[model samples]
Target: MSSAKYHQIKDHILTQIRSGQWQEFQRVPSENQLAQQFAVSRMTARRALSELTDAGILTRTQGLGSFVASFKSQSSLLEIRNIADEVRERNHSYSCAPVTLESIDAVAPIAIALGVEPGEQVYHSVLVHFENDAPLQVEERFVNPELAPNYLQQDFHTLTPHEYLSQVAPLTEARHTVEAITPNQQMCTWLNLYNEEPCLQVIRRTWSQRGIVSFARLVSPGSKYRLGGHLTFTKRS
Candidate 1:
């Protein structure tokens, strides 16, 4: 089948879901139904459904059928709101201590994350976040200059990188990973953590309309911070 036909089928289904024609966990049309409706082969219809399933917008079962995935299932750590906002929401004062802010040559790993060539000049910033004068998180970030040209000139003391980037570029997607490790000497000093204290490290990559926007590593002392959020789940009938 032509790629356009399959994509059209996919877009139709996505429109239904987005338009609220399909609710969470509601079964979508079977492949046969879609094929008949779109005048495409069952294989083509299946390809569209398969792609949506892989994208986490739908779920498929062998005996049943494809259904709209639960909203919680599509949730990602990258979707978490800005840290400064989170702190203020808890009625605490938030401040950012600038540690490093400059343009640097991207290394291989940074290049891979930003989808840029190695040695390309990128804007880098490091800030230790504080809540009421006690350090809480170390935010190390690199920005794609192509996406946010004035990244280096931002007054982070008054506005966070997260806030700045959101204004400059519209976010399209985000990726996140979490790990646990002991704080290094630099991290220990910044976060007021002991060397043996484990830290929750969250690495995030964000994309804007242009392309990859920024890559960030956030470290919080495990004893002082924990990641928590409430997710609504549909009860099965």
Candidate 2:
């Protein structure tokens, strides 16, 4: 079969899945049925389904036929929002204190997150965000130098790192992991917390069209901060 025929078959299946005609975990037509409908050989139909399965759009079982893959749940914390804007929107005064901003050699962990080699120079910044004179968040971010060449030159106090990076390289994707931890001595001092105080930590990695944009560790005193969002769940039809 011609490559175009296989792709056409793939596109047809994709259109059905994308349009919600085929719901998550809903069984798809077998290769024989697809071949008969598309007037193609089983190999051609199988190629289409195999490609979709490889791309995470479909799942196939040993005895069962292909089915639409379930979409992964996403947290609103992964959504790109300016921290300064969030504070201001709460009807409180917002301020940022730039604690550290410099070009540094990426450590192993930083390099792995940024998809760069260790010892490569990367832009690093630490800023404390305040709401109504109270420290609300401590942001420690490592930026890919290729994506934001002059990241260190920006005045984070005036324009937040998020704001600046958004202008330079529009975010394409972001991944976040949240956890609770006891604040370290330095973190406590920065956030004005007592010893053994728990904090909510958000570790986020973001990407742009160019490549990995930044990896950030944002910490907030648990007593003063909470993360909440709503997600709609859809049932298979």
Candidate 3:
């Protein structure tokens, strides 16, 4: 199968899903169907679907055919978590690449979030997290220098900021604000998302013994990741 033809198959599936033409858990065209439609061999069609499946865009069962995966990955809004641990728990391979790491003068909204004055210097870092080699999350964070000194020195690829922060200043409290967002081009590129795909954003502020430690914006393609938790209520009568 030429790359173009296979890419066409993959692109068709992706387009349907992103355009809401196909709903979650809906079964997609079978290998034979795709083979006939694209005039390609069954092997080629199967490979196309396999690629999507590996990318967390589809789920294939033994007897049943492939269906769009359900909110492929998840995170808890109630607790601060190490993304690496979350991915490992799902039995998926996890990796990360730090895009930006440097010191910057705090600006308005971020300064307020980190409780630092506007001219004060703070550590700023941006990274992308991957699951099974597919980009899953874009993490942009600002750290209070007073709280986590040497913030820009650590290797984020090996030790995520979440993990390093935990070791330096165990989380004592946290706040999370989540919303749906339209990602900018750069963020879309980082998450390997189409421009029209919806994204979930979590603006988080974490505190430790020292005070507000970090403020982070965590964004992921809505199709590939989700955020929620199980909660139980007691009778209050």
For residues 1-237, could you state the per-residue lDDT of candidate 2 as single tens digits? 558888888878866865679898999999999889888999999988976664445777879889886543333344567888898899999999999999999754466567787689999899999999999999999999999998988877789998989999988777666777788789999999866888998877777778888888899999888887656679999
lDDT of 3 by residue, 1-237 (tens): 467788889878877876678887999999999999999988889988976664445768768999976542233347567899999999999999999999999754455567667669999999999999999999999899998898899998889999989888778877665767788899888988766688998877788877878888899999988766767779898
Model 2: what TM-score? 0.66
Q: Please give, for residues 88-193, the per-residue lDDT of candidate 1 as tens digits.
A: 9999999999999999998644665677876899999999999998999999998999999999898989899989999999777776656676777988989886
Worst 10 residues of 2 by lDDT: 70-79
Alpha-carbon deviation at 13 in model 1, angstroms: 40
Give one clash count per candidate, in the order shown: 0, 0, 0
The residue pairs found clashing in candidate 3 are none
Each model's lDDT: 0.81, 0.82, 0.81
Displacement of residue 137 (Cα, Å) in model 1 is 0.2
TM-score of each: 0.65, 0.66, 0.65
